[model samples]
Structure formats: structure tokens, C-alpha cells
Target chain A: MPTAQGGTLYRGREGMWSWVAHRVTGFAIFFFLLVHVTDTALVRVSPEAYNAVIGTYQTPLMGLGEAGLVAAIVFHAFNGIRIILVDFLAKGPRYQRVMLWIVLGLFVVTMAGFLPRHLMNVFGGQ
Target chain B: MTNATHGTPAVAERVGTLDAPRSPYVRKKTTRGNYELYSWVFMRASGVVLVVLVFGHLFVNLMVGDGVEAIDFAFVGGKWTNPFWQVWDLLMLWLAMIHGTNGLRTIINDYAERDVTRGVLKGLLYLAFTIVVVLGTLVIFTFEPCPAGADPELLASFCTA
Candidate 1:
């Protein structure tokens, strides 16, 4: 039997870590979505107000923050798909570890494609 | 598997059987058939779609053309004018709200100790979720980036033209 201590500390297999990561990432995205919706809703108030709010996001600090958000989103999305397969497919739980590696591989590749472009847009000269 | 009496200790001594066994802990079984199963399935399906919708939104708003600087009222107005973007934004709004709300519902169920507390918290959560989603959907569909009656100075420059 698994001990509560081990489970709490995430001292289990890849599946456990994935579950924890999913929860963490889910919370992060949830909070961000709250703020994002409020800010986007500013558009309905006035053009100036909306632009001013979004303009704050153009700074170097926010650019870095955006990168972190993107990373959270990518990991959560990839892991979520893995979870779906495991829950739905007959052979999925048996090969979950293999699927995890595939998810990680996809995450890295997608991030590689996204990061350079995002960084260029943020840091590169006009 | 036998229908043992409530006061009988024999039920406790019995091993696993084909019949459903009682547990010390109270199990919150679902009354609705396959609802939870479908809900789990929906999370995955919506999540996959959200990945695409959200990434596309970020890519366009923060990376395309002049990038983040180009995003403003007029820019949004231009995009919303296109049926494609309108639908995209609509899907993103609905999917993300429902997905996030359901995830939080799960969290609340897991963590909340008291039934009343859990119900109250979930009630509030659902209320907030409904308000935001409904308002957002309305705004997306009814948005006029440049209202004719609005103050011209406050309106986007595109509106003045």
C-alpha cells in the first residue's frame, strides 16, 4: 500500500508527478484567466482604457511573465491529453510512462518553436 | 454477498464478493448515469481544443505583425469584424470557462470537509462562472468597437474616420 507521506511529497511514479503538475498548472491558468477576462472586458468600457491596460503588458517584465504562462499552458495541455488517453483507452494506463515521454517530447518541440518567436517579438528591435 | 443484518459482525469478516461491499467511509455515488464519465471526457476534449484556440489567440495578439504594440481597440475591432476570429474568440471563451470551472469544482469536492461549506463554495463558484461566461459571450457577440453615440475623443481613431 502507498503511504500518505509518499503521495503528498510526490515521491511516486511519473503518473503521480503528472497529476500534481496538472493541478498546479490548472490553478495557475485559472487565476490568469480571471485577470485576463477582466482586462479584456475593459474594451467594452472605452478604447483608451482598454489600450492602456494592454499596453502595460508590453514591458520586459511582462514579456518574461508571458513566457512562464506559455510554459504552464503547454505542459498542462500536453499532460491533459495524456490523462484523457489513459482514462479512455484500454491499453493507455499500461503504457502511461511511454506516453509521458511522448508528451514531454512534444512539449519541448512546441516550446522551441514558440520561444524564439515570442522572444524576438519581445526583445528584438523594431 | 449475502444480505447480512445491520447488527451482524459477519459482514465485516467476509472477503471481497460480487456484491458491492460497504466501506467505513461514505462514498458519494453519482445518481446520474455516465455523467461523471462524460464530464471527464469533456475535460480532455475541451482541453485539446483550448490548446489550439488559446495558442492561436496569443500568437495573433502578442506575436503577429507589430506584435503586442499593435493590439488595441482598433486592432480588436478589425479582428472581430471577421467571422472567423469572432467564432474563435467565442469558442475560447466558452471552453476555457467551463473547463476551468469544472476543474475547480473537483478541487473543492476533494478539499472541502463540510458538506454545507462545500455546497456554499461551489454555489459561489458556479455563480461567478456563470456571470463571467454569460457576460463574456454577450460582449463578444454584441461588441461594437466604435459606437456611434460615444465620445469621439475616447473612441478609437478608426471610429472617427
Candidate 2:
């Protein structure tokens, strides 16, 4: 029987949470890629078919979904770099908690820059 | 064998030593040599490149002048018509698919305990990967910016020129 208890160093903390987020986001992004490729392939069918499919992506609902997707990508990208550092740098494990904070900071900043422009484009009317 | 008449109870002949089992000892090497090691390295390497490729893609497509609203057949045709954008998208498609496929493979292995279950999930995953990669590559290579029968309104402006 596994208990909720975690040892002093790794579990029940930033390290575990980051890993969990990484997996969840990666799972979502993978499925999205499959669907995206399929949709894009509609171009080969005909211009009308392609436009009909892509038109849905411009809707407000899908725009919000895109924002969420971008958020996931940004976090995953920053955290991925952190993971590389952890793998290659000698001092990586020691400063992993700090690096996670840095990753989060970058996520916030990137999304801040992205969300407003995307939302305006989606809702601002052509 | 001791005789009962000698005051020692008869004992059946021992088939094997108590310390060792009857089955032959075969070492269980759980991993195929270096396959998983290479996968781990590939994930990291591809991840770095994907960060660059994917970020640039999003910035150009989503954060540029009109964002998602500007996307349509014309937008796509215009971009794919250029050799630079063609190569960029091709690389993005291949690298992203491979990276995502490998990530899903790791997830499937971690969660799916049964051999049959793991095999089935991975089979589907790889199948999807193959179809998407081949389709995307062909689309990039075969796309026509202007089809004679296509509605001019739907085609890129440059197509008419």
C-alpha cells in the first residue's frame, strides 16, 4: 500500500508538480498535433474544404482554446530547458526549485505578451 | 536410501538441492541494449529544437498582424508557396510529430502495465504518427498556390498575378 508520505528531497514538492504538469501538457499537445495535421491536410482536398475547416479555428471558443494551448506550449518549452540543464549541469539538481520558479516567471511573461493580442484578434471583429 | 530395518526411516531420493530450483537460470535483461538510452537523449535534443521551431511558428501565425482571424486558404497558400516557409513548415511537422510520438510512447509505457495494452496503444500512436507525417510532407511538397478551377476569391492574391 502506497502512502501519501514523501521523502525529504523529491516528492510532494515543486519537482513532482512540474513533472506532473509536463506529462499532462505533453499528452494534450500530442493529440492536438494529430488533429491539426489532419485539418491542415484538408488543403489538398480543395480550397473550400480547407477554408470551411479552418474557419472554426477563428471562433472565440477555439481562440480561447488556442490560448490555453499556447500556455501549455510555453510552460513546456521553458521547463524542457530546465530539464536539460538538470540532466547536463553538475549543479542542476541543487537549484532545480529555483529553476522551476524561473520557468514559471517566463511562462507568465510570454502569455502576458501573447494573450491580449490573440484575444483582440479573435474578438475585435474584422 | 536407508533401510527401515536399520532403524533409519526411509527417505525418498532428493530430486534437487534445496538451495536451487529445478528450472534453469536464465538472466532477465529487461531492456534492449541502448534503445531506451538513445530515446532519452533524442527527447532532449529534439525538445530544444522544437522550442525554437514551435515558438517561431506561433509567433508568426498567431501574433502577427491579424492572428488566427487572418488564416484561411489564402493565408496557407501564400505561406506554403514560398520555399523558405515550405522548408520551415516541413521541418516543424516532422520534428514535432516525432517528438510528440516519442513523448506519448513514454507516457504509454509508464501507465499501461499490461503487455497487450501497451502494444495496442503504441500501435495506434505510431500509426497516427506515420499517417500525419507522410500527409503533412506531401501537402507541403504538392500544394499548388493557384489551382485553375479554384475560386479566385479563395486563393492567395499573388496567385492571380
Best by DockQ: 2
Report the C-alpha lDDT of model 2 over A71-123, residue by residue, as the tens digit: 99999999999999999999999999999999999999999999999999999
In model 2, where do residues sit more than 4 Å from their true spots?
A1-10, B1-31
Give the docking tier of candidate 2. Answer: medium
Error of 2 at B111 (Å): 0.8
In lDDT terms, how accurate is model 2? 0.90
DockQ result, candidate 1:
0.43
Give native contacts recovered, as a fraction, per prediction. Answer: 0.51, 0.84
Docking class of 1: acceptable
Q: Write the per-residue lDDT of candidate 2 for residues B45-156, one digit (tens) a residue.
A: 9999999899999999999989988899999988987899999899889989988999999888877889999999999999999999999999999988788899999999
Q: After superposing candidate 1, which stretches have Cα over 4 Å from the reference?
A: A1-11, B1-32, B149-161
Instruction: For model 1, name the residue pairs that clash.
Output: none
Best by lDDT: 2
Q: What is candidate 2's DockQ?
A: 0.66
How many clashes show up per model?
0, 0
